[model samples]
Target: QQQVKQSPQSLIVQKGGISIINCAYENTAFDYFPWYQQFPGKGPALLIAIRPDVSEKKEGRFTISFNKSAKQFSLHIMDSQPGDSATYFCAASWNTGNQFYFGTGTSLTVIP
Candidate 1:
């Protein structure tokens, strides 16, 4: 079963703009929410994350907003640039690094 659903299969944003990607999950047991950014020919890297205890978490230009009650979350990329163009995915796990449920993915393109 698809536990997580992502929106905007693809996105195009102007340089220096904000890029937003959203995701929703069905499992209430998921406690860790992490967003991954992947470039062509590269493995997805942890971009940012938030736990159910926090409503939001920010690191550099990447931020994650989480809602426990709604079982939803979103990623916000501020000051988006061409280099930021990549595939973004949202995932949920039990924090054991055993398994994760991922979204389909969102292709983001930032053009100048």
Candidate 2:
């Protein structure tokens, strides 16, 4: 079963604009939420993340807004650039963090 649901299978953003991706999960047991960015042949890399206790987390141009009550979370890319083009995935994990339930994926294209 798909534990995590992600929307907007694809996205296009203008340079300097903001790009957003959303995800939802039903399992309240999940304690960790992480967004990943993947390019062509590379493995997905951790972008930014937020815990259930945190409403939001920001790292440079990347931010993750979490809604624990709604069982939802979103990733926001600020000042999006062409270099940011990649496939983004939202995942949820429990305390162990070994097993992760991932969303389908969202391909983002940042155009100049």
Candidate 3:
């Protein structure tokens, strides 16, 4: 029940376009949801997040839409740029583990 699977393993989009990725989880007990963005040879950093208590959350160019009923969520990158080209990961975890179940990793290329 500790898993979050993401899709499109990789994505190529034009600059100033929208980038979308989806993820789902099996554990209903998970309470905290976070999306991470990582650059080459770097650890993933918290991009944005939402809790089961909310339906969606947004921060600047990044947005996270959560569906509590479906146990699913997605990340949307608005105005994607070449600088945004990197690996993105979707993750889930409870407050207990300090460890998160991560997606296989999505390598995004924003074409200039």
Candidate 4:
């Protein structure tokens, strides 16, 4: 079973709009949270990540909000563009991690 639950199996966002995806994790032992972006026929690439020590993290137009107490995290895409259309996944792992537990991905479509 998956430890993380991701919502909005698919999303459509107007160009320049904000695209948001949410995720919730079950295991408190999961200290490392990472968001990945995958293009078709390619491997998922690390987009952003956060530790329990940090409340939030942002890189460029992407931001991650983590609520450690709530065991939840979310991804926000600002000024979404057509090129940004892709599948997004949320994952969790421990400090001594070997495997990453992935959430059901969200397919995003940025309309031009």
Per-candidate TM equals 0.97, 0.97, 0.94, 0.97
Writing each residue's lDDT as its tens digit, candidate 1 over 1-112 gives 8999998899999999999999999988899989999999999999988889999999999989988888899999999999999999999998576598899999999999
Tens digit per residue, CA lDDT, model 3, 46-103: 8898888999899999989999999999999999999999999998888866788888
User: Which ranges in model 2 have alpha carbons more than 4 Å from their true place?
Assistant: none
Worst 10 residues of 1 by lDDT: 92-101
Best candidate, lDDT-wise?
Answer: 4
lDDT of 4 by residue, 1-112 (tens): 7789999899999999999999999998888999999999999999999988999899999999999888899999999999999999999999775589999999999999
Question: Which ranges in model 3 have alpha carbons more than 4 Å from their true place?
Answer: none
Global lDDT of each candidate: 0.93, 0.95, 0.90, 0.95
How many pairs of residues collide in model 4?
0
The residue pairs that clash in candidate 2, if any, are: none
lDDT of 2 by residue, 1-112 (tens): 8999999899999999999999999999999999999999999999887789989999999999999889999999999999999999999999973798999999999999
Model 1: CA > 4 A from native: none
TM-score of 1: 0.97
Between candidates 2 and 4, name the one with more favorable TM-score: 2
Clashes of each: 0, 0, 0, 0
lDDT at residue 34 of model 4 (Cα atoms) = 94
Against the true structure, whose TM-score is highest?
2
How accurate locally is residue 76 in candidate 4, as Cα lDDT from 0 to 100? Answer: 98
